[model samples]
Target: MAARGEVSTGVSADSEPEPGWLPDAAIVLSGGRGSRLGGTPKGRVRVGDIPLLDGVLDAVSAAGIQRAVVVGHPPSLERAGVVVTREDPPFAGPLAGVAAGLLALPDLPGKAWVMVLACDLPRAGEVIPLLLTGSPAEDDGAGVARERVQGADGWLVVDDAGRRQWLAGCYRIGPLRAACAAASTEGPDGLVGLPLRAAFGRLHLREVPDPHGASADVDTPEDLMRARAAARRSHRERMES
Candidate 1:
């Protein structure tokens, strides 16, 4: 991994190169206030012994994304190749965090794609590959090829309950930058307090199904308990296997 805000060759010499369809970079939105969790920083909150932010970063690294910007003050500041930044005024909103992350990322080609993730998701490791490769079980016979649909701005995860998880999506950089620019103009406060849907509404996004509830995020204490329980169950299953 490269140093913070520095660009890298992406794949290490010992590692296999990522598929062409995978994202070139990532923007993690971790600056939320986590008010429901008694003001604890969601990124620092532990999901089974691991910090939520570290878990998310590990997933992103495993996905072969070398360039990433984490938008928030996480407990671990010096993640290799990942830049940590805070949104202006801090805790403005997810949209503001997205903007900050985007700004922090190094420039990429027009065709490049970036994964936008939230730090509170315990299942991010399982969720990311689904975002990059359309789920075979949910596809209409097109399989993973559905991910390359022409002119589509990106793919957003539709959780089991049918709600679109905007922060869990992967987007083409050009369209996302355009959306951010348009969003910035909408309010004197810039992207602050702007809803993600209002910013990204114009883009042509495909809905990918989250078959395993992988898009579930930790918000309240109950959500955290559920995540920890799920993590323990996964660990037990892996050990048995």
Candidate 2:
């Protein structure tokens, strides 16, 4: 574990096998104003003993992504390679946070992909493999194969309720940069308060289904309780195994 403000490069000992494809960098959006949670920073909210932000960081590290920029306030993280930053003007929405995170990341090839994650998810690590591998097969009666979206701008996760979780997607860096640039010029606020849908509207995206509810995020006290319960269940399952 890293001390406050220190960097760590250690990978999770229990991390699953590395996928054939991995994002070169990750952008973690953590700047939301947890209004529903009584002004508490969601990143600092613990799902069990681990802070939500740390849990998200662990997921990123477990995926073998060395470079990550966390945009918002987060507790001291155990992983060394993670960078902590904030959106310009503070409280600027997730779009601004993504732009800030991109700026914080070292330059990489245009073809390199970046994982964009929101820091409120408890089971974020479980979805990484699904995003990396490709979209999940459609649930039609016929058995289908999971196919990668070639030349697509990115892969976005569709939660169990069929809503797209834009912040949980993996994207090609080039298109993402272009989208951010275009989005910055859209209004006087630049990326501030910009909706993620508008920013990535032009890019083609493959929808990956979240069958395991991995994209579920904490938004309220009730949500947090559910997350805590889920975490306890996971812990028990592990212990039993």
Candidate 3:
């Protein structure tokens, strides 16, 4: 955790994972103010005909994860068919949403790997599966160095520019829960006010490179427009070829 959207490197993945290895759950954060897009809920915004959140959820489902927690306003998540939760006092920020989402899951053992994603990733369906490929298991004994915990703890995808995308990573539930618990102690509002970077710094994280450039998340009006254009372009390309 450097700052929000800051890049940090040093951790690396081990050998390829066993066949059929995948996360057991996903936590999709949908609670953004959309201040750059006129205060609209980013989850509710449509890139084409599909809502941004829907696309992300579809990707999660396609990746063989049935258990998902969507943290956002109830109204926006009503029909998503996943656990819809919200951070207390609302608009607390991404870390608070992560806490809320973690709280929504049932207590179960070995369901350690959890995929964390943002609602605005238009290409989530394709990108998420790619991220899951060749992931290291928690028991790999990769050892921690320079604050980087190898194996099971989790790996996040970095963009082409080698920037780590905190919201677009997979994490181990045990460490994630512990981090949330520790971050909750900071203020009367609990984890709601915690910056994601500050909270995640507590975990041992590695980075995966995103060569396909599918981790783009819509944050501004221009981003929305680009998403729409990309969707249309993809559709046209598919129809033509």
- Go through the candidates in order and give each one's C-alpha lDDT: 0.79, 0.77, 0.73
Ordered from best to worst lDDT, the candidate numbers read 1, 2, 3
Please list the residue runs of candidate 3 whose C-alpha ends up more than 4 Å from where it truly belongs after superposition.
Answer: 1-16, 74-81, 134-152
TM-score of each: 0.87, 0.85, 0.82
- Number of the top-ranking candidate, with TM-score as the measure: 1
Q: What is the overall TM-score of model 1 with all chains considered together?
A: 0.87
Pairs with steric clashes in candidate 3: 137-152, 138-152
State residue 101's C-alpha deviation in candidate 3, in Å: 0.6
Better of 1 and 2 by lDDT: 1
What TM-score does structure 3 among the candidates reach? 0.82
- RMSD to the true structure for each prediction, in A, is 5.3, 6.8, 7.9
lDDT of 1 by residue, 96-118 (tens): 88878877764675456788999
Which ranges in model 1 have alpha carbons more than 4 Å from their true place? 1-20, 135-143, 146-148
Q: What's the number of clashes in each of the models? A: 0, 4, 2
User: Candidate 1: minimum summed lDDT over ten consecutive residues — where?
Assistant: 8-17
> Can you give the lDDT of residue 158 in candidate 1?
90
